[model samples]
Target chain A: MKLILLLFLGQVAPVEVRAFDTPYDAGGSITIIWEMDTAWVAKVSRIGIFRASAPGLQDSLIETLYKPDSVYVDNSAKDNVPYYYRIVVYSDDTLIAEGKTASAAVSTQQWFNGKRLSVLIILIIYTVFLLYFIMRARTNKNLYIRKIAGLEAIDEAVGRSTEMGRPIVYIMGLGYISDIPTVASLAILKRVAYKAAEYNAEVVVPCYDPIVMVAAQETVKEGFVEAGRPDLYKESDIYYLTSDQFGYAAGVDGIMMRQKPGAVFLQGYFYAESLILAETGHSIGAIQISGTTAVTQLPFFIASTDYTLIGEEMYAASAYLSRDALSLGTIKGEDYIKMILVVVILIGALMESAGIRILTDFFSIF
Target chain B: MTTIIWTWVAAFFTLAILSFLYKDNPLYKFAEHVYVGSSAAFTVLYVWVFDAYPKLVIGFKEKAGMQKYMLVIPLLLSLFIILRFIRPLSWLSRWSIAFTVGMAAGLGITGLTQGFLVPQVQASFLPLFVRGETVGQTVLLTMNNVIIVFGTIFTILYFYFSREHKGVLGVSSKVGVTILMLTFGASFGYTIMARISLLIGRIYFLLHNWLRLV
Candidate 1:
């Protein structure tokens, strides 16, 4: 704040403008700011801003602002294009003070953003824990993942199918081969397929994507080989049905009707078709176990299925079932990361309560 | 006249799907086959014409110097996808899968942090006391904020895996489950509303388009 007495003075200090590329942005934006003289600011009628794309070109008048104005952001400047800015102060159109930046401000792309430094740090910490735990697990350290009811029941579902002399139907929901949930679901299917092979119960997998069908075949075959039942593994058991959403649902529903499968496993990325599949299984009186990360489909599974794995549970199901060290270690690492987030939120709340925004401001950077 | 024919076709398929509520039948089977066959054909055509053509043919034709050479990256990646069909070369598809999955994780982390983590954390902070407000409003506002802060924290606690969920952790997880259940219930209700509205739209289509009535 400048002293109020400065308003009566003939001259105010020259406007100092600082122009730099906007942080955390893709590119092509430059933020401009000029220091304000709060006291001398009263006397100034307006300030006119001018910009030139490159040096020696005529500065185009961009904007004008009245008293109390201190900043003007020029976003029209293209990336790699040099920008020069001039700020002119006027009292009733009579120029009182003028300043122009000597150096050109050019917007450049930043691969690593300074603003997301906090998020990057948190990610690194989580990754370190994940790698360390995975290493420990690979070395045969027992990582105790909690007893997930949905996973434990997989054995019972497979056994029941075997005893009843019925086939088990596994729908690896409607996700493409590349989806994370689909990957996790495939992991769980390995365990399911192994259990089915061990018990000599037939397991049929109907896939939406052709690539997923291929992956499913490999997984089930590998599972049977691991279970020492490779001879029992049928190549045609896992097949690509259709890619159409409702058509796939109809196909699966038809299998549930005709085959009357004893056990049904629904996992991966489901959509509006989840209700159709789960509700049909319910009506068929099959022991249905459903899991997915799709929040919208959770209720249908929960309402109709015997056991439903909630969002993260669907991803963690394979690790819990197979007790793999690396996967278990990764889940533990994610837990620790969640704890860190909780701490940050608590500290932010405390700061906000005290009217101190230091912590909250840091979190808001991203 | 052309539109009328298409409308009748669409209406026929729509009714075939709706027949699913009664039982799976031959009519439903026909619609299912037609839908799958047409959609697969459409996807192949769409990918070839829109994406594959421009990225490959046009890049080679129009791209200059270093830009043209850079097309080899995508070209090689796509070749991995083609390898999936060949029995011996099938394992080579892992390269493309790894590239895609790796990119998805990297992109997901960035988006999740910016879109979910930061905004949600900032939003969780709420000032308890107002400098100049009635006591009732202050209590209500403070209570609202307190519930938001606590609910979010405890719900996240439920997902923890290192220490077995027992003792104090167990209590927190119980609360977390409650919050999660409430969220699922609300989401289910919301989805049901949207689904019902879609049903209404189909019903209107049946009444107006198929039957030609009000």
Candidate 2:
């Protein structure tokens, strides 16, 4: 049997094996690749991957592949550690041929992932555009920003609330203070709260988060101070409700029902409770303006609210309401970026249609 | 006996909450207050027990060297945030807030680019024309790709705030709005089904768990 096996093994060439640290990764992984004569492939029933700390040490089998797979990644390797690898080809239960790496491969943590180079490039370009547009906007104070109805109705909403002798309710939805939407909502809150203060109409804010409640209090205070009515700033009005989603909704609904506010501003991130709050506001006959980046809840806002800021519109609200040169420039820069993205998509689609995958490959090379 | 009492209590609260559909009254108010008050208290306890105790107290006990020292930064930042209550030292809280805001911005940019932008743009790069086994299959694939390509472009154009919606932009935006509305319609239906399922669950609980009717 040994003589017959030797003769059979001698007929096929040794498989070429290479082991190396996986690139563009944090670390702790090694990739092993093997190439063998195609003619000898049919005879191989399985391949086994074996690893060891050193060349002289006994290699322990890590994984076995039943099929003729050419590549395997060993994710169990330790970072900054050298590893020796061996690949064994087996016919049924018997080892027929084997290959080993010429030298040990060391898995090292990469300082930077080359895969994210494109994202970094895009970000740098966007920053440059934003800075340039901001400079331009400083000189040309008349930078054009298309009108947003939701933002425009702020004054009107406040005025109506004042006329009706009713309060204005501003509910920053279930978002942590760290959320960008919540930050954006704070900006809009400053403006709305300022208007309410000027009109001598109360702006009630029921917060979902304690941190957000504090932020809202500060924002509303600033708004009141700016409106020369610091005394009207009620810290008690902008209070934390409950952390629970449904509980927050119930709390807000109760506030809306009890206060019967003339205008309601639903802004920031919301979940399933979006519709509940919006519908309650609607039922109370409050003129509702809702804004969020939550795609799942936008339809609920649209169906229930008088004015809805969809997706990016909410992001643009701060700049739109403020009309500040720096903010407007950023918005313009973002719009230009959107245009570039559109052009890139069109070009990529065209290239893909022509069966030239250059553009597709460029985007896909993570 | 305790299980039966708890079930009865749960049933009472459920009925009280359901009564809000007809009109707001004392029962609904009682349930609402209970829910909010308990949830707030529960959340405080939950955070202290799960997040604060484990990550801070246990981490301090388990970690060593640089890892242990690393916990100090977060501890100090958290302490600074809590300092907002001190009127004279309130400005110190801004440092912690600034750190949070900066971190959020950095994470947002990287996350949007890596998670959404790159993958979305790559997936949108579909062959406009496909040659399949049959002419019908080929046509269908081609149409699908066309819709995807155009839909993405038009939808993006709709959100372009710099340019006023006019001419080609207007037409494209209109198409985009139509597609968005259609998507919203489908989403509405899907979400309603989920909400209905939740309602069904509640109904099942009332019958099976409480009344033993189902």
Candidate 3:
């Protein structure tokens, strides 16, 4: 089998490299093209574009383009400096062939200069505002924040689960642990674990990754210890259920049906399985509070879960949970930025409608 | 004949993904394991053949003149990763974790400044006036620009948290929240459309590309 695989790969022709015109009128970009051999093309999966300053430069790999096409455009290159590009063909992650270097020189154009300037100014103003608020918050000055009703309901959810003598099931979505939303999800889990510990309610966490399972177990253990219920902590409470997406979903669904937890906390990044889990939890009469940055899944959660935290709210879970002054201050700063955005949008709209160029011209100053 | 076989493979994958609607089964399990194993194996093989072997190994041989020594770093790293199976020496994996985290943080900070903060903020600013434009057109452009700028600013303000919300600042913050919520709603709508589009595209491919139904 291995010999056959090697011979098949050897028969595949190397990628062909050529320079071609980029799609857009933008002159600074150039496309690199290659051809796939017949056998390889039939089974070919994706092409990877490796870019560098010159050929044989090991440390200069700048980017990888993942696409099935034999061509890719280097759109972000600057004029005057030459760029060397290489292409690699892969089938299911196995490298089938490599292409030679194609060099391209970029030149700037005159079009879109006006639009670009306006964009630059607006970006500067908003950035300045963000930095100002961040500094203000950092200085520990008093910042007013509105109450989040969902946050207030956290205690109620835990207490209900406790009173009902049912477990509190917390499931982090399939988002990578490194993502901000996933971190925020873990922060919420920390709070939930603490509350559950205080209520003496069992907490079950079925994770999709071994790494996440480890982090969650540690966080839950710390939460229980802090709540003076360390004795209730069990390793099995936070267990690795397969890393497969739908498999994990199935395992979680089974747990929801059998354990029949009182409160189900769904936090983190979720995809299609979100609705399935929430609907199941809803059927079992569990009070479900869900938070995710996956906008596509938000509607499903909103329809099924009792309470939902939208977009940035998930990122603010730490602030809401800990009420840490710094985090809260950041939230307040974000609010100020939002307000400025609204006013600018309204004024821009009005000025455009009234045939007054001054408002827009003034805004262009940034 | 080959096309038919490929079509069958694709159809099988599509059905395997859709099978979750009914429940998990052996077919789904097989598909899932195949995806995971193939993806991981493919990643390793690609890195070896394309990245590691070409750039690091062969390039070093041609240019650096110390191919044998240069191969040591990656070899050791790969070895250490495999040692994760050993219970006691697992802590050695921290080196990889630290390296990954450090690189990610560095890249993130640089990207956040150039890709996000700079361009987004710059795009927000549009002069209140432009020369040689009609009054109505100018007004319309200005209003749109203002909304964009205002939205960007207040949204950032709404995230601030050093002080208490008691007075005029409180009102501004509330407005910020409203703008942010609207943005969220729009984003949510767009995302739903995007995912639905992907689903449609997949179904279209299954029908047209595979089954020839279309």
Candidate 4:
């Protein structure tokens, strides 16, 4: 049908149409290019574009475009379906020339986005360093991480709670079970729980997430089990209250107010509620040690809490607390990687100043 | 027809929650419970209405080729995660979690590198001094860039873990701590401003919207 229409309109005038698949895209796009014949320039006032899917029974008029608008991208093309495009010339609402794609075209998926090669390159660079460090870590178990003060204070805090004869309140902030900082918080929770068990101090953990509650229960149980105080581990101690941020904060604040717990462990992913929890713990005269990966909430924790694992130091804190060689090695590796990044940045800047485009351009995203 | 009644319901819940400022009580509990329960229900509703129906079901139906059929991958993965409900089959959920954690790590690397690292490095290449400009503007821009350049380097150095904090490196790390403290103060001020703004909105609602005393 498209052939017949084009042939019928060919006698009027021939307007050549070019259609090809768009490149460097994920899929589902085609570009159409056409030129208005110089001879037909005076004869035609405007032009139209139409596209039809396979088994073309009809044409869907896409646009009625004017002069100097000869290019269009048919991003509306579907994945599997072949698309045929046409250019129609209208001289005062009369069909003057019609040009259609000789063959049907389908958009194909590209293996890679060449435009984002720089991203892939940098990713490879980071991966190489990570792998190298991991390999080196297998050998270098002697690697040392600087002493994180917050972690060292964990024992002191737990001991203080034991001495005061008050329960230790450990609140895991409202983060999903899968959040990295939350996982790290749970590790530290285990450490604190073990210390509490050893000291025969009751450890009260109020969880925001039910999943985290179950996890924390298991963790604290393990801590007591490891401490050879299985009899002291009570399932009722670690309980789920509510997941709502404010509600959890209020619940924690209530615990802090009523018990005036000797030591409060505020750790994990907290948002606006960081200040609330820390401030409440402070008001209760509890020795608070807080850590969060949330950059925005750190200052509140710093201002209110006694010891803070600043930023990424929370991850290092877990390894530091555990005193695991593998974890220490990984932290050391990460430090080395940071140095590499620093060097790269400095070199890139110098190159930029020197008008040496090679280094800077190679790292350019676009 | 229900607009006035709806307003009353909202206002009641608002007051119930606000009452917590005095102390936790039954009203506060009622409001908090309602918030949690409704939020959970809304989450289910959203997954069904927006996500499950539109993205999964409709997409499966509308999708024509390999890409459309590939939707089964995530579907199967989700079903595996649902196995956690069955205690004996709970170990199967680990596969799903592994997939999620793996994808998150992969995507996080991409996001952190492109969204943060690259743009940050690119943005830091500001000129040390402005050429062919008035001294005031030149001095201001130069100083701004200078602080940014030094602060960025120093802050990163402060977080540097491998080296012992002694000598020249120690001095820079100290400077980094100072910069970080200044940044924390700025962050606190900004955050407090936002919180105060929210408080102002709540106060306005109590005065005009609910109490109608304005």
Question: Which numbered prediction scores highest in lDDT against the true structure?
Answer: 2
- Model 4: interface root-mean-square deviation in Å: 2.8
Count of clashes, each model: 0, 0, 106, 0
Model 3 C-alpha lDDT per residue in residues B73-142, reported as the tens digit of each score? 7656556655666969765655554454456555654455456544454455455444437888877876
Model 2 chain A — which ten-residue stretch has the worst lDDT?
A: A3-12
TM-score of chain B of each: 0.92, 0.95, 0.77, 0.90
Residue pairs clashing in model 4 are none
Point out the higher-scoring one by TM-score: 1 or 3.
1
Q: What lDDT score goes with residue A241 in model 1?
A: 80
DockQ per candidate: 0.54, 0.74, 0.10, 0.33
Per-candidate TM-scores read 0.87, 0.94, 0.57, 0.77
What's model 2's lDDT at A197?
88
What RMSD value applies to candidate 1? 4.4
What is candidate 2's lDDT per residue for A128-193, written digit by digit as tens? 989999999889877888878899888998999999999999999999888999999999999998
lDDT of 1: 0.84
Error of 3 at A61 (Å): 27
Q: State the TM-score for model 1.
A: 0.87
lDDT of each: 0.84, 0.88, 0.70, 0.79
lDDT of 3 by residue, A31-88 (tens): 6777765556665666767667555675244446555576666777665456677777
Positional deviation of residue B23's Cα in model 2 after best superposition, in angstroms: 1.2
